[model samples]
Target: MQTCEVETIIQAAMPEADIDVSGEECNFTVAIISERFEGQNLMQRQKGVLALFEEPLKTGRLHALTIKAFTPAQYAEMQNTFLVQLES
Candidate 1:
């Protein structure tokens, strides 16, 4: 599936998420930030996103997806670090 299409599906699952999608047509990378991820461990957070595309994954319309999930606080920290790296 297309990157935007994949992004739309995941965003629908977590409306508050900040998402960036890139890569090949059927395989893509997704970075997601959402308040809904709060208090959830890595596995749980991953599962939450995976659940959103259970059907697409099963049908093979989507070949592969790499996901990075984080809560708002975590994402803020990460964003700051990224900005720091860019500035340096």
Candidate 2:
């Protein structure tokens, strides 16, 4: 349930993705950027990430997971918005 372990699992499933994970044991928030998500809808993207943690989730080893999935362009847009907010 460590962030690194969660990250590892996700990376194993999607090696090309760029992932950032935070939070403590049993609970995590993940932000993932990947081309694989380009044509997928929100739920589809979430499911694709969540599916990697099925065992941990089912066993309660991972209690809560919040996911933010995006394509590289989407992530860049989000980052730009964040920077603009910071400047304001």
Candidate 3:
């Protein structure tokens, strides 16, 4: 997926989120910071975010994906070192 599309999708789902999307073409790396993730675990966070691209992923419109999601506080503490990892 394109960077703008990836970013837009995430932004739509989590309007208050701070999202960073990188990589090229169909492969991407996304870091999402939101208060919505405050009480969610890593898998829960992954599910919620990945759901936004279910159709694209299934249709092959989106290829590889690397997602790291965290609450604002967590991101502040681990900005240089991700606390979790989820890949698709």
Candidate 4:
């Protein structure tokens, strides 16, 4: 699946997220920022994302995926931000 479509599925689950996805079209490197991730541990946050793609992964529609997930507060601390690029 295209990263945009994958991102859309994730966004449906976590509407506040700002997501950037790139890779070999199927394999993906994803960066996500969302308030829903706040206070959640790394495993939980990753699980939330993985849950969204369970079927795709299981069905082999997606080959591999790497994810970087962050809470809005943590994302704000990033020296370079993704949301600003999206807004513009």
Candidate 5:
């Protein structure tokens, strides 16, 4: 429900991941970075995270979830691009 709680759940599922969660009570956006996603396809990567919150999703405690998953290298690249855009 809360950002920290969502973050904790993702962290539990992927202990080595770096997770950032944001949004209101029942809706959330999550960004997860980990080597575990390296060879996976996009659907697989998204499914991996969605599976962690099955119960909440089923119970409607979590209404909406938007997820972005990437490997560490991808995350770094994205961050660099964002920074460049800000400077432009």
Candidate 6:
């Protein structure tokens, strides 16, 4: 599927989210940061996002989807961790 279509699907569900979709054809990696994930566990967050692409995934329009979903604070922390590791 096209990247824009994948992005549009996710964005429609989480209007307040910051969504990033990369890769091509039927494979994609998605990173979503939103306040909506604040109290949810990792499974809950990932499941909710994956659910948005269920139809596409089932139909093979999306073959592989790697999801990285986080709250704003979590994304900030993850970025810091990666930066620290690079510096070390």
lDDT digits (tens) for residues 1-88 of candidate 3: 7899999999988999999999998899999989999989999999998899999999999998899998999878774455443321
Question: What are the lDDT figures for the candidates, one per model?
Answer: 0.86, 0.94, 0.90, 0.85, 0.93, 0.92
Give the runs in model 3 whose Cα sits over 4 Å from its true position.
79-88
Candidate 5, lDDT over the whole model: 0.93
Candidate 5 residue-wise lDDT, 4-71, digit = tens:
99999988888999888889999999988999999999999988889989999999999999999999
Question: Ranking by lDDT, best first?
Answer: 2, 5, 6, 3, 1, 4
Best by lDDT: 2
lDDT of 2 by residue, 37-77 (tens): 98999999998888888999999999999999999999999
Which is the better candidate, 1 or 6, if ranked by lDDT? 6
User: Which candidate ranks first by TM-score, i.e. highest?
Assistant: 2
- Locate the minimum summed-lDDT window of 10 residues in model 1: 10-19
* lDDT of prediction 4: 0.85
Ranking by TM-score: 2, 5, 6, 3, 1, 4
Clashing pairs in 5: none
Q: Give each model a TM-score.
A: 0.85, 0.92, 0.86, 0.83, 0.90, 0.89
Instruction: In angstroms, give how far residue 54 of model 3 lies from its true place.
Output: 0.6
Q: What would the per-residue lDDT of candidate 1 be over residues 4-40, giving only the tens digit for each residue?
A: 8988998787777789999876788899888888889
